[model samples]
Target: MKILVTGANGFLGRNLVEQLRNQGYDELLLCDRNTSESELEQFSQEAEFVYHLAGVNRPKKETEFIKGNTEFTEKLLHLLNENPNNPAVMFASSVQAELSNPYGESKKKAESFVQAYGEKNQTPVAIYRFPNLFGKWCKPNYNSVIATFCHNIARDIPVQVNNTETELTVAYIDDVVKELISLLEKSSFNETSVLYEITPTYKVKLGELVNLINTFKESRNDLSVPQLNQNLTKKMYSTYLSYLPEDDFSYDLTMHVDDRGSFTEFIRTPDRGQLSVNISKPGIVKGNHWHHTKNEKFLVVSGQGVIRFRKIGSDNIIEYFVSERKLEVVDIPVGYTHNIENLGESNMVTLMWVNEPFDSQHPDTYYTEV
Candidate 1:
């Protein structure tokens, strides 16, 4: 399927693109400010679906918001109108778009533009109003609470709770992407407007979230005993002081490094995508064979390694010398013989993004050169 994605580099955009690509949609048109009008038009002609995510979010001024959110969206809708065969369009409208904030106001205006365009063209517009979204690629300094909490906890600092009683809903990035793709493939929108509230299955209290951070911190520090404090005000104050760091705490949490040079990590699903672990000792290789059905993307997470890959029926041998200084992602296509070895003093970790789920029985994998 030919698909176009805006804000392709942003957090949500990246996740969505990855999902689309994994589903075998390779003819993807990724657009952003860096993308030109010519490029957009070229893709618009070929794409069967357009996922509009590019816009100004959390602008400092109202004018900035109007230009980023409203004007930009109108421009894209105009582009869609010009296309003779209008492809299905999915607009990423924020829950804030329906609420009252400079960001929300701008998004609301953009939503109106989408609705008007859809009605005029007699096309179906799928609008997803997302609540607070948090996952990988999320930066700490942003308004996202998950990033803030992760940042504070990674540095052994306490998180601040603005509203103790307020409950917020969070949907994992995978779930959100799945829902979007489902809607796109289904294309069952009968009405002019198809709105869905995107959120996690459950809601979490703000104060309780803070406590969870503290619990995680304690577990990480290997603290066996729990500190008991009766005074609510004093407890909050103490937690805040104990966890706050000395330096710039607002830095991107994803890039935060420990003494060992490990950044904050995320859980990986083997079937869904790739996850890499470091091999401390040399000569350690995870897979020495080839998977017939598994297509994988491998990137050195840290240290150095020597990767050897050869496809069957080819006498040629290819080798890559990878290091921490050079961030190179090697795509291990299906039915290829490959092996990797750590070549540095430090451990070698590689993140692997796979196209399909891991299966042991019908692994579609075969050993070569034993």
Candidate 2:
């Protein structure tokens, strides 16, 4: 089906477009200030539905919010009214619109326009009020609390949080997109206008949300530096933890700390690939075995370690000292024996990206005397 999506480049809009495309809707017209009027007109002519998502979401001044949100909706409605077909339109409102704040007020005004248009005209309109949205493709700015926490943790920085145990609901981007697609595909709402609230059913505590983010960071073998600033105002603290950029890395293996001093590994499997392990704690050592069909690759995420390797035909030993701020990608040929030991006080973590899936059978692993 032909569809038009505004604010196409924005975080949620981008995800919605992807989901639509994946569902076999490719005849999409994307409209934003970035597109020309001619482009919009062309899109309007071709689309059977329009997902109205464009607006001035964050205004430095209060008046701009009215213009960006309310006025923009009016302009789009006028265009739709002028068209012969008057295709169905879905308006993306926000939970804030029903509550307080200039941003919410503006959205409510836009929503009113959409509701009135749907009642007066032949076209159908669906309004979806969204809550906090998170996941990949999240932008760095514009008040994203989840992104902020993820960014701080990735950088090993402490995530500041308010002491309040207030409940916050979040909607994963993928799920939101899926719901939008389902609404578009179903004809049940055609007989009348519809308004729906979208959010994950479960509510998470503010502190628990921060901890979940920290867990994900640590699981990925990433560094976390947490700082608690008790002196800042609550509002300032909230704003500070809402727009952090994510860290992207390529690695072959990830080491995570478990209940005790023991470590768990997230190893990426690749045939004939090399894996590197960086030891953060002195005297800690890793695997002392060789794989038959499992080739591996490794790089140190942080700290220092020593790699020892041996071959069946050779009696000689080879060792390499890996240090922080250094990246070493190693390739272990099949049946090659190796082990790693840490040489520092801090715990070592490694980033790993692999091409194969894990398998327990025909393990392709054999141990040798150290």
Candidate 3:
């Protein structure tokens, strides 16, 4: 199908167009601010569907709202009216349309035009009133607080909250794009519907939102992974990472080094325990310890190593030979003292996952010769 997308360079427009291309919709009429009138005329005639996403959200002059929004929408509909296809229209409106401001008034007017054109031509039409939206590629510090907060906080910039109790309804850009793509397919819902709402919107308070974003910044130093079980947090975390400065992609981890080698914590989770990397030099041995309630899995990824195990009070010793040539995991069972020794001429590197994070007060580990 030939789909025409206005504001094709915008956040939502870019996301929607990318998915369309991925889904094999090769015939796309991408109309940006610089698109010529003659080209738009040709696109309007050839398009089978129109995503009217072009609009002015934060124009410097208030008069530009009507020029970019209402007037432009009328012109597009006029061009499409002359075509034989009578293509379906999907209008992206805002919740602020209910207000009397200039931006809202312009959107309200554009919505009226789309509805009338659909009624007169008897073509598919839908008007979606979106709430605040956030995701990667959204510009920061304009109208979206979520984007602004995510961008500013990721860079250690101060964020101001006007009211602690201020609540916001936000939608993830991926969700919105998914919904829009579904609407374009032949299996659409209520083709002539005047109003449609997207699902899975998150409502968050200003104070709580600020606190959640702050924790993401603090996670680097604490080595604590933020909880992503919730959708809002998952989306916010993704958006936050996208706003990070290009030069700040990597972070330094604290490494405990000794004659044996170096041990560094890779990831720390509250419920999922911890992951660490252990490096041992040639002829070096590490991890002569036993745990009561803790368990671990060690995977040797480089060089050759030997793992030895013995019960706390037992004398029988069990040994397992491991090498980088054959990747394997050795589980450390409770009540068994364990140790890994480098058997190769080169250094041995292993990845370790423990059942719980290491706590100085309750280490749960007891050193023993294995």
State the number of backbone clashes in model 1.
8
Q: How many steric overlaps are in each model, in order?
A: 8, 25, 0
The sequence of per-residue lDDT tens digits that candidate 2 reaches over residues 43-151 is: 7777778898887767788999888799978877877776666778888898888788999999999999998877777667889888777766676445677667766
User: What is the lDDT, from 0 to 100, of the residue 330 in candidate 1?
Assistant: 86
Query: lDDT by residue for model 3 over 55-93, one digit each (tens)?
Result: 999999999999999999999999999989999999999
lDDT of 1 by residue, 250-365 (tens): 43323334433343323334335434343445556656688777777778868888888888778787888888788988888776788777778767777766665445666677
Candidate 1: stretches off by over 4 Å: 187-192, 199-201, 221-370
TM-score of each: 0.58, 0.61, 0.97
Model 3 residue runs over 4 Å out of place are none
Residue 202, candidate 1: how far off, in angstroms?
3.0
lDDT of 1 at 113: 87
Highest TM-score scorer: 3
Reference-based TM-score, model 3:
0.97
Candidates sorted by TM-score, best first: 3, 2, 1
